[model samples]
Structure formats: C-alpha cells, structure tokens
Target: MFESFWRANGEEATIVIPGWQTMSYFSDVSNLCWFLEPEFAKQIRRLHGLVGNAVVEDRHIVVGTGSTQLFQAALYALSPSDALQPIPVISAVPYYSSYPAVTDFLHSGLFRWAGDANAFQGENYIELVCSPNNPDGFMKQAVLKSDTGKTIHDLAYYWPQYTAISSPANHDIMLFTASKSTGHAGTRVGWALVKDQEIAKRMTKYIELNSLGVSKDSQLRAAKILKVISDGYEFPNSIDAKFFDFGRNHMRNRWERLREVVRETGIFSLPEFPSEDCSFTGDRTSSFPAFAWVKCEWENAQDCAAFLKSYNILTRSGKHFGAGLNYARVSMLDRDETFDVFIQRLYSIK
Candidate 1:
C-alpha cells in the first residue's frame, strides 16, 4: 500500500547505522526503559504531537518488538500476581480476533481470557479498547465497568488516515505501532504511552526479559521513517511528501470504490460511518478504515468467509471475532493492484 510512497520520498528516510553506533544493550542507563533509543522516543513523541492522536506529554514510553508484545506485557503488568485466580482479560464483542488467542495461549497463571467484556462478571479484569478497531472499525470504550478493572488502549488505527482524531487520547496505557502508522511492519517497532510509571516499568521489564531489548537497528530505522513523516507534515511542499494525506487519500478512494461495488451487487453490506471533525486534518473527514466489516446479505451465503473464498477473495471470518457467520473482515491495506483485483472480483460475484 505504501511502497510507492516510500520509493518516491525515501531519500531523507535513510539511516546509515555503523556497527559501533548502537551496539550496547542499553540505550540510556538513566531512563527507566533503559533500552529505548532516545532517537526513537523523540520521533514517537514528535509524530503523535503532530497528529494529535494521543497525548504523549508526561507519559512514559515503553518500546517493544511490536504492539503484540506490548499488549502481552500489559497483561503481565496489570495482572495481580498474588490473586487467588488468574485475572480475566476481556474485550468487547467483534473485537480484534487475536486478543483472545494471544491472551489465553500463554496459559499464564496471572491472566486468562474471558469472553466479551460485557458478559464477564469478574471484578478484576483487564480490558482492551481498540478504537477504530481491527475486525470491525468501530470506536469503543471500556464496556466492563468495575473499580478494580484496568484498560489497555490499542490505538493502532486511531491515526488521521484511518479515523478522525476527535481529541487527543488520554488513556492509562495506549499502544501504537509502526506497521499501521507508517506501513513499516518489517521494522516491528511499537510503543506504549503509559500514564503510570509502575506499569511502564513492568511493561519494560517484560520486554527486557523477553527480547533482551528491542532491536536498536529497528529503532533507528523507525526513527528515520517517522522523522521523514513528521518533516513532511511540518514542511509540506509536495503531495507525495505528505504521509497522512497520502494514506487518507488512498483509504478514502478504496473505501468509496468498495462501497460502490457493495451497493452494485446487493449481496454484501458495509457499515455506514459518520464523518467527524479531525483535529489534525482540520476538516470533517469520514472514516476510511483499514479493515472493512463486510456482511453477507445473500440468503445462501451462510458463511461470509467461505463465500469470499469461493470467489478467490480471502477474508477473515467474523465468527473468529466473536461475531455471527454472516460477517467477514476484509483488509483494505493491500497494494493498489491487489485492491483493484478485489474490487473487480466483488462486481463479478453473483
């Protein structure tokens, strides 16, 4: 999706890291997240401030392998070790499918997966709030109301390109990743903006023990990419140079096309989103989500995923996200050519 954008504007995004530049295990011995490269931290704050997606001021940054690792670390940090039973981890229905799989697979005594935050009766739980959520692009909050519960905000899709930044998010633990933000999944860099120092430390400790520290090379590379992105916004001379603008345009166009095909076929339906004012874009922009929450309207199409597959269109089953068989999750982040093929395929569907 972003390959062409980078190929054209990657001159300033290059980092020439020498062998001896960042070879040590520790980036800053004085900082609590000792392995977090200063350059990466600086770039993260600068980008977030520029986008107005999250409030990074006075927040502790914990760099991880990716948002997945940071998510697991959050589970590790929030769960009470001395509790009589494992702390239940819950997210709203039609949540990111990976949440339950990631949480329960570990079989950790500290935390366990409990289906649907709305249905969970336990008082002690950790809630995952993925605004501009993955499987379905809905903005969500902590559905479970309890004094003892903690929330981890997965703001991966909260960027201006995906949805409106109505206001800067000020959650207790907010997660952001480079993959969704800059289309740099290979770098595998993600950070958490945690309000509490103790939780930040615990998250950092999990990383320290898990991977020894996030790769300094990866951090440096991510820093360069982010710096270029922030610079584009600060000094916008060309359309090609603007990162978010480019992303927003691509998403909007793809969504418009997708919606058109859905309307044409009368076999599928998409969620209708209301346009909202974006603080960063400074305009009322409609949501151009990274994923489409597609529903099968045809009576014979009992399984949405399998139906798409019959037409050689791959999609994730909504059942995996705790939704009914009628729904399917389609990725809108593919390259331009692939997306065009998908659009064409949709029209061919009976």
Candidate 2:
C-alpha cells in the first residue's frame, strides 16, 4: 500500500547513495560509538520534534540495526553484571512474541525471561511496556511497581498515524523503529532514547560488541527518509501529501473495511478503541493499528489461527502472545493487492 502511495505522490523521498558515500564504519569522532550516525541522530530529533510523539531533549540516542537489537541492548544494559542471580525480564500478557526468544537466546547470567509482569514477584526486574501494544493495539503501562524494577517503553507503534500522540513520551528508556514509523523495514535501522547517561553508554556498548556498529548506508537512508517526513510536516504540499496524513488515512480506511467484513461474517470479533483528541492533529481520532487482533467468536472455531490457516490466510496465533487459542493477529500493513485478497477470503468464510 505504501509503495503505491510513494509511486503516486512523487519519488522525492528516495535516496541515492554514492559509491564512496559513508564508506567508513565510523559515524562520529569517537570510533568507540559507531552505532550512531550524526546526521541520522539530528534527523531523528527533528522528526520527533515535528511529530511531538517523543521527547528528544536531554536524551541520548543509540542507533541499532532495528528495534529488535535495541530491545536486547536494553536488556543487556539493565541487567546487573555482578549479581549472583539473574534478573527477571517480563511484560504483560499478549506481549510482543519475540521478547522471550531475545531474552533467553543468549542464556546470559545477567537476565532471564520471566513469563508475565502481573504474576512475577520480584524486587529487581526489567519490565518492557509496549504502549500501543503489538498484537492487541492497546495502550499499556508497567504493572511491576518496585523501585528496583526498570521499565523499557517500546514506543514502536506510538506514532500519530497508529495512535493519538497526546503528549511527548518521556520515559527513561524508549525504543522506536523506522519500520513501523516510516515503513522502512528493509533499512534495518532503529533507535533508543535514553535519559540516563550510564544506561545509554551501556546500550551503545552492547551495540558495539554485538555487530560492531549499524550500517552507515542504512543510517544515511534513514536520515533522508526521516528528513522527508519532518519536511513534509512543515511544508505539507511539498510532496503533494504528508507521510503521516497518507498513512493515517490509509490505515483508517483499511480498519473500517476489515471491520465491515468481519461484522458481516459474525464469527470474528475485533477490539474496539475509543476516539481521543490528538494533540498533533488537533482532532479526535480513533486508533489505526498496524495489526488486527481478531478473535474467533464461533463456538466451533476455538483456534482462530487454525481456522484462518485452513483458508490459506496466515495469522499469528494468540498462544504465541500469551493469549487464548481463540485469538489471532493479522497484519494491516500488507500490500494493497494482498489486503484485498485477504478481505475476500475473510468474507467468503462462513
């Protein structure tokens, strides 16, 4: 869908990298901190300022291959290096599916994957709070209230297009991705905004040891894309339409059409989101989530994923997200043709 939009609206957002451009692995004066590209860092701040979705002031930026890397980096940074026992890392039910894999794959002594935040009874822990959560698209908060517990706010879907940007998010550790915000998943670029300098250094160190540093080419491209987005907000008609406006309109329409189809089937149910005033847009708007959390309402269809899979409609089972088998997740960010086919298949199902 976004590719079609880019094709129609002019390709001014496109970036052409020269052969010699960003040849060096180093992005700044210090070779130690190669994870961050100076231009990309500046552009990120500018973009966040224009959108008002995140607070950039007084925060240290740490660039990663993507938010996935930053998630692990945050885990590494927060875990105690000298502790005898491993720190528990957790999120609420229906959380991001990859959290467990990412936390436990290394089998590091610093941290270990703990099931759910509500069930966890620990003093020192790392809680991941994904506002505008992945599967269900609900706003979330940290359930663990211990002072020793650290919280990492995953704000990947907290953009104005996905959800209302009521105010600037000022969390100690926040993660944002270019894939969800700019539809640049191929670029493999994401960033973390850290309030604490020590934590920021540790996260940057994690990136340094993990992959040496992020790709310079990807960083340059991300900078260009972010610059385009920021510039579009300032000069709305420069590219005939702004990126957020286009995305928000497209997502809202898709959600409406999907809801209509599901309602007609009467076998599936979707979560309802309330309308709220978006400070950036200056209007009340409902959420246009990136994924559709569909629940099987029919008594016969206990496993929603299996039911969808029978029709060749692939979906992420809710069991992976710690939910019942009746729930499943479908992407709303697929291409226009794929989305149309999905709607057709969904409507045809009795």
Candidate 3:
C-alpha cells in the first residue's frame, strides 16, 4: 500500500546543471514595488510594443515580480466590494497553491475550494483558471456559464513551444510572464487581459499599491528580450534556428528521456498525453513544451515528491497541482549528458 503512496525514488537529485533560467534569475529582488529606472520603463513599453496590435484600451498591462504577482493583482481587482457579501473564489484542488493563498491574502474570506468549475456557483466567484495548467499541462477550454460570469485564464506557459496557439488574447484576463518562456524571471514582468475597464483600473491600482510601480529597469530588460523575440533573436542561446525550435527540441528530448526512464523500469505508468491531433483546427498539435508532467502509479504525490527530493531531484509533486496525487512535475531543460545521467540514476533505482 505504501509503495503507491511512498515518496518518489529520486529525491534531492543533484543539480549538476541548472534548470529553467527563471529558477535562478530572481534571487536579488529585495523589494518589488519601486518604480523602474527611466530606460527600463521605456524598454518595458518597447517590449509591449512588440505585441503588435494586441494591446488595446480594453487591455491593461502591468509588470509584476512574475505572473504570480499578476495573479494576485487580478484576484484583488475581482474582489467583492461589500465585506458583508464577499464573492467566493473557487478553484480546483491540485491547483497552483498560490490561488488559495492569494484568496486568503485578499482576505475575502469567500473562496470555496471546489474540485472543478462545475462545482462552483456562477454567482459566487470571478473564477481563476490556469490553462495548459501548471502540473498537468492540460488546457481548459474557454468556458462560461453565461455571457457575464468572470474567468481569468492563466496562460503562463502558452508559447509556441508548449502549444501551437500564438494569439493569447482569447481568454479573459489572461496572465503571462517572461519567467516561463524567456528566462527573464528577474524582470518580474507580467500582463493581464482585462475586458472590463473598471477591473483594469483596479488591477493597476493594486500594482501601484503592491510595489508603487514595477521597476523600469526590469521592464526594460524584459522589453529588450521581447523585441529580440519579435526580431527572432534568441535570448539564452542566440542560435539561428528559431527560439521556438530550440525550446521545442529541448523539451521534446527531455520528454523522450523521461519516457525512456519510465519505460526502462517495469513499475511505472503514464496517462495517455493528449495528442496535437486532438487540438482544435487552428491549434497546433506539434508540441507540448515547458514541462514534463507524469502521473506515476504512486498513490500520493507528496510521497513521490519526497522521494525525488531525496535523490536531489527537485520536483513539484502532483498534489501541488490539485489532482492526480501519483504525478510529479519535472523541468524539461536538460543537456543530453545530464539527461543520460538522470536516466541512469532513475533506472538504477529499484
């Protein structure tokens, strides 16, 4: 019984090579609310300028320490005004832990942790949905009970590497950050797609309150990276091949390695990953980059996470994602040599 619920077999996995750039870029931010330097502000504007007709008066852009900050701001904007009748914040379990925590910090005292949107009453919440969801990598369809019920889609990993879809404005209050795709976590820049003018203003207010204003320097750096992305220049590795190609190949190889690791051992299992063929007509089924979420047969994800950590392999357990306790999240950024060693270590276990 414990075998299914036991800790991961790859705990404390040595980090001989670093993971995503975001993991290491943000250790120095002592504070996040200060105004950015002038050039930095210009740079941020430049980056947003690359969006190319994507931004409109209806759309409000704000920089955050990361999408995490934006998420908080969006929640605050949606907070109920009347303390006596607070709007409920509902989310799936196994969700990004921040959702509930942010709900608490807003002190709305109205969040109801329902297992899924179906359980959430429309009148209760301005829903927060994470598509291409954190641990599972599954994208929730644009859903609405009626024309007016609110839903904020978190598309933090929706770049071409992860999904073929490029236009990110389809969802309401879309949340994104460079930390996931561009490796610029240090900039702490993020944005939200707010269809409501009032909510947009409130979000800006929250941003101002949270950090006075996001640093202009960080915003500038992010803007530079955005310009390069628009110009087809790679940030971490300025290779001739498209950055999306690099990311796709990199993640694809890692996922293959993961498959190899799991297949080599007779004791593991995986859910059938939805294929690109399953994508909508315009959706590209070509890639699922950014992460490798695997559902292990383990009964409890926390035990699986503990096991991985014991091996010095820092992994976020599935329970953290709000479902499938047997699963764990793994970064797909790995060199072949590191991946080989990781596989060897994984196979060497039991």
Maximum-TM-score candidate: 1
87: Cα error in model 1, Å: 0.4
Assess each prediction's global lDDT (C-alpha) against the native.
0.92, 0.90, 0.57
Of the two candidates 1 and 2, the one with more favorable TM-score, higher being better, is 1
Best by lDDT: 1
lDDT by residue for model 1 over 1-350, one digit each (tens)? 98878989988887898777887899999999999999899999999999988999999999999899999999999988798899888889989999999998868899989888878887788999999888788788888777888999999999988998999999999999999999999999999999999999999999988999999999999999999999897877642499888899989999999989999999999998899999998899999999999999999997999999999999999999989999999999999999999999999995
Q: Please identify which of the two predictions, 1 or 3, would achieve the higher lDDT against the true structure.
A: 1
The lDDT-based order of candidates, best leading, equals 1, 2, 3
Error of 1 at 275 (Å): 0.6
The lDDT, on a scale of 0 to 1, for candidate 1 is 0.92
Off by over 4 Å in 1: 237-240
Off-target runs (Cα >4 Å) in candidate 3 are 1-58, 109-115, 142-144, 166-168, 233-241, 275-285, 298-302, 309-312, 334-341
Instruction: TM-score for candidate 1, please give it.
Output: 0.98
